[model samples]
Target: MRLMGLDYGDKTIGVAISDELGWTAQGVETIRRTNRKADMKRLGELIREHQVEEIVVGLPKNMNGTIGPRGELSMEFAEQLQNTFKLPVHLWDERLTSIAAERTLLEADVSRKKRKQVIDKMAAMLILQGYMDSKKRR
Candidate 1:
């Protein structure tokens, strides 16, 4: 079984896939959002290609652990994914994931343009990694 992770945003959806053992998550690609049908079609293709059995979506919650508008959007996306794919979709807290991704990129001296191109994918990787790490802790 394989797991997929998504960092859903207004402009793009960052995609990540776990290894066969579910130990590591690797950034796949960033999907630029056009419309729901197109977006889902692309996602379906990835799911099929990866043989993904489960999905984890990043939910951007407030520092207080309260779901905000962004988190609500992620929740709706996750629900839609569950209904459309008939696969279990989990929401993982994504507070500061993007910030962390940016910090890492900056520390590596990534050009601003390059960082812009890959930040979402990096964030998705972090989100998935965090979720997998939490599972390992249990």
Candidate 2:
């Protein structure tokens, strides 16, 4: 079953989708969050379009592994997603995914403007790919 990955932020949500075989994750669009209802509507559309069976949401934990306010927000979002879509939602620890994504873009010599546009999407892909890789190891 295909899985959807999300890196939820205050202003936007980065989206990624797993391949049909659930072997790889690809970066999708970044949704600008207008409101909860609108965000849910857009997510529902993407879910249906991609035939997503599950969702993996990045949970931003502190370096000390503590769930701070942002982490709480992610948990709430995950709960909403599960209730709305009736699909399993998994929270994966996403401590430094964004930093790693930025470093990757820098290594590739991506322009700052371009990097800002796609950083979240790249982070989402990394989150989903990490989850998939962990599953494979089990």
Candidate 3:
């Protein structure tokens, strides 16, 4: 089944999609945060377009494994996603995914401005990649 990954932020949402075979993930687009209804509507459209059967949302956990404010927000988003899209939403620990993405972009010599434009998407890819790798290990 195809899976969609999300990195939810206060002002934007990073999106990613797994391959048809669910073996790899590719960065999609960053959705600008508007309102909950609008955001879910856009996500629903993407879900239909990608034929997404499941969603894996990045759950921002503190380094010590406690659920912080960001983690709570992510859980709320996951709940809304489940209710709005009627699909299974898996919350994956996303500690350091953004940091990892930033490091990768820096190593790639991505321009600062370009990195700013795509950082969220890259973070989403990192989240999804971790989930995919874990699945493969199992």
Candidate 4:
């Protein structure tokens, strides 16, 4: 079954999807959040198109392993996703995925403008890949 990943922010939500075998994740697109209804509608379309069976949302916890405001926001968003999609929504710790994505892009010599546009989607892919890897290890 396929899985979807999301990196939710105040202004945008990065989206990624796993391969049918769930072995790899690919960045889909970044959704610019204008309102909840629109966001949910777009996500519903992606969910149906990808045949997503589950969702993984990035939870931004503090470095000290404490849940901060951002973490709470992510949890709330996860709840909304679960309620809307009627599918399991897992929260994956996203401590440094963005930083890692930035580093990866820099190493690849991506231009700053392009990096700015794609960093969130890259982070979503990283988060999804991490969750898929953990499931494989189990």
Q: What lDDT would each prediction earn against the true structure?
A: 0.96, 0.97, 0.93, 0.96
**Candidate 1 — what's its lDDT?**
0.96
Superposed by TM-score, candidate 4 places the C-alpha of residue 111 at a distance from the truth, in angstroms, of 0.9
Lowest-sum lDDT 10-residue window in model 1:
65-74
Give the range where candidate 2 is weakest over 10 consecutive residues by summed lDDT.
115-124
The better-scoring model by lDDT among 2 and 3 is 2
Q: Please give, for residues 1-138, the per-residue lDDT of candidate 4 as tens digits.
A: 999999999999999999999999999999999999999999999999999999999999999999999999999999999999899999999999999999999999999999989999999999999999999999
After TM-score superposition, what is the CA distance of residue 77 in candidate 2 from its true location, in Å? 0.2
Put down candidate 3 lDDT per residue, 1-138, tens digits, no spaces. Answer: 889999999999999999999998999999999998899889999999999999999999998999998899999999989988899999999999999899999999999999988999989888988898898999
lDDT for 62 (candidate 1): 96
Per-residue lDDT, model 3, residue 83, is 88
Query: In model 1, which runs have C-alpha deviations exceeding 4 angstroms?
Result: none
Off by over 4 Å in 2: none
lDDT of 1 at 107: 100
Please give each candidate's TM-score.
0.98, 0.98, 0.97, 0.98
Q: List CA RMSD, all candidates.
A: 0.6, 0.5, 0.7, 0.6
Error of 4 at 48 (Å): 0.5
Give per-residue CA lDDT, model 1, range 1-138, as digits (tens).
689999999999999999999999999999999998999999999999999999999999999999989899999999999999999999999999999999999999999999999999999999999999999999
